[model samples]
Target chain A: MSDLTEGPSGRRRGRPPRTESAGTRDRILSAAREEFSERGYEKTSVRGIAKAAGVDSALVHHYFGTKEQVFAAAIEVAFAPALNASEVIEHGPLDGVGERLTRFVLGVWENPTTRTPLLAIVRSAVNNDTAAAVFRRLIASQLLRRITARLDLPDAELRVELAAAQLVGCAMLRYVIKVEPLASEDVERIIARVAPVVQGHLTGP
Target chain B: MSDLTEGPSGRRRGRPPRTESAGTRDRILSAAREEFSERGYEKTSVRGIAKAAGVDSALVHHYFGTKEQVFAAAIEVAFAPALNASEVIEHGPLDGVGERLTRFVLGVWENPTTRTPLLAIVRSAVNNDTAAAVFRRLIASQLLRRITARLDLPDAELRVELAAAQLVGCAMLRYVIKVEPLASEDVERIIARVAPVVQGHLTGP
Candidate 1:
């Protein structure tokens, strides 16, 4: 889920240097997210994504190389905003880190547009091993570790995961499972209640 | 999952008057749990479960009626113990309820034998809509509501799900996803840290 400022578009291979390549790549990722979310990892085929993107299946294979690569790219793109928060929290006050982290994480899930791809990645990862691996690598390395590394406290990693557990557990119930009340509760109201515990985990005695 | 005292074995119907009916029923459920956990809802079939159980596929249908029913039974057996915690929490002091609830929940995941079936149900429910529905109903109604009903307070249900969100979220990361230090940290240490937050969620201002 790292944004990889190295620029994914710059790394394209075997394509004529046309301006539309980026457009096509973005379109493929968009289609893949939708199809993967709707049909899931096992059922979502490269051809299906291509068909949805209005491109040849071969073009998808050409751009992303494999379904797994496509999924990885989609996740990175979707989580780009949330990934930025890691940097924000890195420089923020230690005391405010929990609030910053909780707000940012839940904020991602709160946005309808972003929530689609985020939920797609989450649902796919929760069930599919490959997707789960992708998710684990991104969250553990890119997101969680980066945030924990900035905390000079003992069990920093454990604290980070506990904070993540609260946010993610809330997201799973509210977004994925759509459990009542929690699902329909006011976004800010839920955040107010959860942020303190997250803060406690981050900076408490 | 709380092992239901209602005795899933005694609930078997339409079988001939065989004394070993309980044993046979248990065998079928055991096989169904393994197969369903391995293959999930779509791929798992009654015939496959029967094969694993060393019985005729007809016997599986006779015992459980359908694949859905077989899965339902398997979940009931796995979650029965965790489910029973609802009653235990129901009578505990409102203030101590949070610790009691968190202890009981994490305790379930800590047990190796129970963790297998519980993990299967969690992973399956995350992906399959049908499985998620079944899980949502069981957790929300059986566990969350029963605990909330004891509170005698407004938004008691909301508080219950939030508490659940914390515990279930931690379980998903610590056990199901096995996400780093949280996964490997001392169980008691985690329970100590997490129980307070769960307590706060359950009984806080």
Candidate 2:
């Protein structure tokens, strides 16, 4: 029943083909990222992604099921580095967690390989509600929940959100909108300037 | 020459009709907002806006010139309240500037009438470079520059961007993405929580 819902390509009962390997899956995901980035969520399609990945459309459906599922997978991979950076909160002394987290997350954005997919997913999420829901789910369950767990207060969730807001907004301006000065400014200098405020959100009175 | 460059319809204008009252101009602008909001900047056209306004496409071109110009006019009206709110930084002592600015900006988001167009413009800005350039120009000149002028430091512009980033990020999470806790929380509560961080960005050492 679930496979039926996963779409027609997944309905086969036999063992998967040798061609349906991990590398192929990564190739499809990479292609999906480029498609979503260039065309956005509404305009991108399974067929389009498959064409870009040099594979059959059925292969894409076999792997990622629907476009929403494909987007979620793409987002998960793109966001993995930043998601892992949530550990900075759990590992460090509480005091500098803000700077550590800020530096690590911004570092992911600074690297072109990571930033490309991240930009694609963010652009997709902002422009389409379905994409936003997928993004919200991953961020909440994977990233925000982890950071929230590390905070001891009852209002810790809200606190984590405010801190997230600070970083996310900076990224939106610096990367997505490409607003001047902020867009061109040095990353280290931005981290230095932004870290304290993030710390204040998490641990300040 | 300028009007010719404005687009084809602007070339025929000598004196606009008596029917082209300020009310008609306003109606066209309002319809443009709706079109941009529903279709985003990339998909929205001056003809679509004119159709929505119950006016001829030529009239829309005559009044607003190009699609970009129409978008700018719509944005100016939608953003006027927030632009006016920038005065808050100047009217009071600098100590609570963060809270005032945060409250005003959030208040704009909290109101549905203003938020609709804001969401459209932001979504458009994120999706298309041309729309983004238009948004960046207005925000940098009309909004950021105003806030920058009020600051006493040499890095006042960067400082303002950081502060803006904090609030902008918060707005993105709360309003655009509709992330919970931040999204559904009381506006006053968010203000209390975020003002200090914004304050720190602007004035903290």
Candidate 3:
């Protein structure tokens, strides 16, 4: 993926050439996430992100074109693991799709490293219209559409959304809302109880 | 009830008594809802709500003691219809509880009058910890506990939460995130597909 990191070098607009473009990009993304988390969407600015990343505003703009684009990229990287969930559904037997999908999605939330950024994204989306639009677009295009394609049913999109709703709600309660039992319950136990329901939504009659 | 409206009369310290006490309280609640919706949880103040209500800040405190109390009161009023959902489960046969519960909860969301305040409460909860705590406490005590009590299962609370997660997640997608076709799908159609999964969470073994 060095080419992916080095791809920006061609558009040199009097900027310094460095071998650490990938590192700089990652630094910018990490700063962006922190800025979004601490300041929220409406209050967070690209300049603020650059300051946090210890990079120039020009570098921030060079990598991610706009504020929404930066937010989208941050979300893309954070959700990269869970986005692989389409594969979990695709590769598995149709009958086992629910359990596999549920386990995989919840597993992503269960991990602290991924959960932090996901929390920031969900909170931002919940609070800001611009963030919500960006989030809706990305989720529909990246995650839901892939799942819909795999199902191959006329109402496959609806089915995928229903399944997604089930998992997303569970995560909200267990993590964001911190409601008891579910919040404090073991992940495996929750999986056992919720997997069947997810399966029913996805593949059941 | 008049008793509820007039309940504050006894504790009235130097406040003028009027027959329009209930009207005043309702007006305050209405204004509180608007303020919370506009300013969000953190920035919203009791003084701001009182200004919106055209009442004294002391009156806002008299009706609802703290900012959290004001928010709690608003939530109570907004969710009054939803809190009645326990009766939907309690007054029905056990076998059809899922459909009844799902339809009832989603129906609350379906109403614009109620949905507006609910949208405010949910957005606040997702974005603010104080709001989330108030939400969690009220939902568990007023709604989930009642459902758990009716179920009479050892794991009834967890079951209730799982069912809640399913519906809450669905609402987040359909209403909050506005992810389509789930966002635009017919409520009845969604109810038809999702009730069973809710049922599976609540009553299925």
lDDT of 3 by residue, B6-116 (tens): 436466532435567667778888898888888788989998998887778877777668899889888888778878889999997998999999999899888898788
Cα lDDT tens digits for candidate 2, B1-205 = 2322333343333234444255677788889988888989889988899889888887787877799888888888877877876698888989899899999899899889888778888888988888888888888888778888888777888888898999899999998888887888989899998888788888888
Q: Give each model a TM-score.
A: 0.79, 0.86, 0.88
The lDDT of model 3 is 0.84
Q: For candidate 2 chain A, which ten residues in a row score worst on lDDT?
A: A1-10
**Could you give candidate 2's per-residue lDDT for residues A1-205 as a string of tens digits?**
2322333354442223455365677788889877888888889999999999888887787877798998888778778877886788899799999899899878888889888878888888888899999999998899778888888877787888898888998988888788888999999899998888788888877
Give the top-scoring candidate (lDDT): 3
RMSD, every candidate, angstroms? 6.3, 4.6, 4.7
| Tens-place lDDT digits, model 1, residues A1-205 | 1222223446664343456567777888889888887977778899999999988887787777888888777787777877876786798688887777788888888888878777777767767878777777788768877887787788888988898889889998888777888889998888788888888998898
Candidate 2 or 1, higher DockQ = 2
- Give the lowest summed-lDDT range of ten residues in model 1 chain B: B1-10
Encode model 1's per-residue lDDT on B40-84: one tens digit a residue.
Answer: 777888889988988787677776687777788788888898897
Instruction: Supply the TM-score for candidate 2.
Output: 0.86
Better of 1 and 3 by DockQ: 3
